[model samples]
Target: MADKEMRAVYAETLTELASKDDRIVVLEADLMRATGTGPFKEKYPDRAVNVGVAEANMLSIAGGMSTEGYIPFAATFGCFATRRAFDQFFLSCAYAGLNVKLVGTDPGVSAAFNGGTHMPFEDLGLVRMVPGIDIVEPSDPVSLKALVQQIAARPNSAYIRLHRKALSPLYPETATFEVGKAKVLRSGTGVTLAALGGLMVHNAVTAAELLAADGISAEVIDVLSLKPLDAETILASARKTGLVISIENHQAHNGLGSAVAELFAEAADRPARLVRMGIQDQFGEVGTEAWLLEKFGLRAEDIAAAVKKALKG
Candidate 1:
């Protein structure tokens, strides 16, 4: 598995897709370099549009572009993409059923030194509220490229949260993915570890290995498709394991934890005990990714401990 930046893969993949599909267009809110869409802009200069720092305007413009039968991808910082452009996202894109793809970079702790204002801890929560919108957080470069292609080929509003920097590859180069599915990386019968986006998937895999050393079999599920989540996979794992733990970089309230809880809550016949591991209702702060993961109790060891505790109680 090679390590590569997801943003760079996203740009390269989008550029490739645009070459074949003339309707594909890229839009940025003056953050092409930060979001790694510069390659797409450079390759297809006429197909790229930078709308300054106005995220709302960028989304609105994407909605208008979608009406013209163009698939537009609007990119910006996660915080600005969702928090600053809720109106445009909900009304202009989702409500109107426009084919727009919203790319949010540096989600959660990936913002690093950008501090709380730039880090988005609740972007998923905000986007989840918009009716008829697809939400995705790719776990690796392969998944990012695959998901970007999927979003571009579809005709619905979608929000894709991803890190701008390089990430450890979670899948092979030929690994393909779908928009509303969860990939089970590891299988177990004791407990199920469900993780979404960023480093959390990597942590969950590590935690599963640690749990195995302790004679605890844990299933690991990479939840790339956030909206219209793969309930079949989640439910099957929960039923087999009888216990579940969700890990994510976002707040535990309305992110992966909440999504899994909602799925389990409705499953009266196959209910499983679920414990969540994530930011404890706190805001992000300035720090390196490693420091922030420790500060927020999102380390692989922390997830292993949570699984141990969940098994006992």
Candidate 2:
């Protein structure tokens, strides 16, 4: 866990980006320590502002800064960012199309011990509904760093959701990321597993093990960008594999699962036996990360089961 941590990678990459870009400013709602932005504040005290516990005020201030030719990366917990200050985000950032990066940490069951109040299972869905807002959830450290660099350089209103705990590295350091495209990690003719965030690598491992046992190879696609979904990649994979399974930490409705389904439906093709594996439209409960994942059927075993079921049906 310590060897491959996404939080540390995010902090380090953000610090590097801040150093390179003079216009980059960071605003946090009393979550600099939790979101690993302390180093940025220490290095660039004048650029980083801690806005106490007011999420709405932080968003408005970030919007105001962006209006003045500044790129503000507002950081806070996922629940606070989406549920607490959604109106501010909509009016100040999305409506105005300001170049503000909304960083939501501790998304989904990643909040773990922080209880249900802190868990943001529907943040992605909520943010995705906002017009002109780009939504992303990187799968690993490498992808996270690349995304941070891209977001820093791009002038757009975007929201990035990160897990509280660290994640294992799934992609190579040289891997290039496109804003609206998905990455195909494995090629197979049996099943296609499309995943986002930390669950992408987990499902890939499960697909590998399942392949060895059942001789049913699974194609794994890492969907880093959620808003502008790579319809071409998704349709191609479904056509090739004949079975599709979507995995994510968020809910099945209005998230990755729903997005994929809508794409397949509009294409009007017999894509595959599609299956959605996620929180099944339920609220998260208080527990450890591992326990919550298992309870919500987001584990590798659960994913493998879904794939098998999809293949058979």
RMSD vs true structure, all candidates: 1.0, 1.6
TM-score of each: 0.98, 0.96
**TM-score, prediction 1:** 0.98
For residues 200-279, write the lDDT of model 1, one tens digit per residue: 99999999999999999999999999998999999999999999898888999998899888898888685688898888
Best by TM-score: 1
Residue-wise C-alpha lDDT for candidate 2, range 187-229, written one tens digit per residue: 8878888988875556566665776587878788888889888
lDDT of candidate 2 at residue 269, scale 0 to 100 = 71
Residue pairs with backbone overlap in model 2 = none
